[model samples]
Target: MNLYRKVVLSLVIALPLSSLVSAQDAVKQLADKLQVMDTLLANFQQTIKDSQGAVLQQASGVLKVKRPRRFYWRTETPYEHLVVTDGKILWLHDLDLEQVSKQPFSADMDKAPALLLSGEIAEISKQYQVQALTSQQFVLSPRTDDGVFKQLTLEFRGASISGMILRDSLDQTTIIEFSSVRMNQPLADEIFQFTPPKGVDVINNEP
Candidate 1:
């Protein structure tokens, strides 16, 4: 699952910081951006590579996210799977294996990039240092070594997220590029849930 989430974006806002903007200002900027994105849907291409610059895996997927903790992510090829959450219960489904794993969206998962979309922005600001690389790009570095990834870079096309780069502690890198971007769009809540089909195994650990 680390590989799956390693590709998740660590996003914030990109603004002029020529005057050495303080952390508080950066956090506020990111909060405003997140607030505006009440919902987001997009097509994404994810690539995972090793430190040697060799490609390890690549896949395309659709991602839908609703504010205050609801998201649906599905990988369409090379290995079909989904990672979804209905705000409380998190689900990981492997279509190839016909299995689903369920658990609470716990504090641990908050350490992942998904927090940028679903968790509290104030809390997130506590964990990452945000820096604007350009007017359309920003980098987020985890304040602690314990974060799942070492560094994250996000690119935006005028408030709509366009790309992400996540580098883990091991130096492995994952790049994600977004297309067909839609923001503040209506997304039905039911899609964020996982329903087990006949013959699929379910491992439920959530209450």
Candidate 2:
């Protein structure tokens, strides 16, 4: 499945960091990187093939990231969905289902690997250990929480993240490759705020 599909799969479970160096020092370095507000936008194309090497999905999109937590994700082809977080709340919109689900940005934010895909590098590296895996790739494994994602591999060329691979407890891996990254740009605040369609089902987890 593709990254987007994996995201939706997370919803079904009501869902649900790292480092190398010294686990504590690594987390600090990662948190530092995430604090950098230099990059505001990233674009890439992803190919997701099953473990059997069968083509499963292909997608392209841009990711807008802002510091202190905020991002907007948009995808193209096959189907469409929008995922946004405003540091406090996470809004997931399913186009086909015409439904939107809201969760505290912190609900599973710390537990889900998907957040790492779009999360601040500093925050991520802080929670996990960082290991140099080849020339352009790195692997991050959780230091405190082992029940979430077993491992996360990230590929980079310079400061741009070229790809992401997530390994969960179920042994399912979701990989995303990125290209055409444009960093240090300006993205509007409205993009991170989504309004679900009227009359659509709204599932509020608030008690």
Candidate 3:
């Protein structure tokens, strides 16, 4: 599976050091919030809408993330699909099809919005221009054209990430609202490990 597509995955703020102090401060605060956690587990509701605001799809799921590139994501609505990465390999499983596809984890996955929580603060600053929209909201615009989304906005409610909005080049928007967020919680290592079920086809794409 194409990680970006499957994940619905989707900057440089410029200013004098002194003039940017407040912006920098906001960025730092958000970064600190993200970095304080080793693991995060949350329930999420995602909606995709077209430019005209017509609903295209909706899904609800659970997500687990471990720092430095490990995550388990499952969609429990309309159908069931699971994507797991153990910092080295990525697995995409389709329960209905009873098939699993595996590939070596690649750095590009870092661009996924969910993974940003595990990324370095300095790297985030370098990759996107950050603007504080409100005390609890921030807008990030990519520095390059390679990203999957045109821009992303993150909303925080007292240090807890509350929502994310991703707008792609096609003008389609994907909004994800998170709840039941548990941060820095101990997650089993097995959760990040994946083994194909009995009789399921396995396709390995690793190089």
Candidate 4:
């Protein structure tokens, strides 16, 4: 997957609703839960599968987020790929290609569901209708068809987020399971910033 799409996919991670609670209740509950995660650090495993339940791709990474729209994602093991944004410029670095891409962070990028945990409580209610499958599991469906993701599911284990599943328009499913989740911990701002290395192809997509 293009790291951009994967980043966006990872953001809109709310899914399947069993509706034990009202939509309004779900939205409020989810918002309240996310609001508590001002700074989050976690290890994640991402699995992509086709509609037939055949696995297509698997990757493991570390995810970090801070309130007011800062994020850092790193894939280590199979390859090294990174996506970083500080609510300003966004960077994507691929070690195999020896390339890095940069672009200005726009309003659309701010709408990413990742911000839901870091900030933007109102946007959650505005963008999606949420229903509770259980007290700790919630499903969200976008209000419009423009979003690339069709539906999202978020699962919480105890007070920490444990898993998320996103299904896109193409019927491809991406499952993210988080481990070693640490929330509301002090994190240095520098973690969200990046500088391209001395010897790499730097692509400036910013206008």
lDDT (Cα atoms) of all candidates against the true structure: 0.74, 0.62, 0.75, 0.78
Q: Which residue segments of model 2 deviate by more than 4 Å? A: 1-4, 7-37, 107-111, 117-122, 144-148
How many steric clashes between backbone atoms does each model show?
A: 0, 16, 6, 4
Per-residue alpha-carbon lDDT of model 3 for 1-207, expressed as tens digits? 433245442410022233478767767866876777788889989888888998888888898888867788888886687888887788888886788888887766666676676555568877776777687888877777874778889988886788899887788788889999988888888888998898999998877
Which candidate wins on lDDT? 4
> Which stretches in model 4 have alpha-carbon errors above 4 Å?
1-21, 113-115
Per-residue lDDT of candidate 2, residues 1-207 (tens digit): 445567444522211123334444544544443445455566756565555666566767667776556767766555677778877778777776687788777634644554564555545644666665454666777667646567777676766667777666665566776667776677777777878788888777653
Between candidates 1 and 2, the TM-score winner? 1
Question: Model 1 off-target regions past 4 Å?
Answer: 1-21
TM-score of 3: 0.86
Model 1 compared with the native: what TM-score?
0.85
Q: How accurate is candidate 4 locally (lDDT)?
A: 0.78
RMSD of each: 4.1, 4.8, 4.0, 3.2
TM-score of the candidate numbered 4?
0.87
Best by TM-score: 4
Indicate whether candidate 1 or candidate 4 has the larger TM-score.
4
Identify the superior model by lDDT, candidate 3 or candidate 4: 4
Query: Weakest 10 consecutive residues, lDDT, candidate 1?
Result: 8-17
Cα TM-score per model: 0.85, 0.76, 0.86, 0.87
In model 3, what is the error at residue 84, expressed in angstroms? 1.0
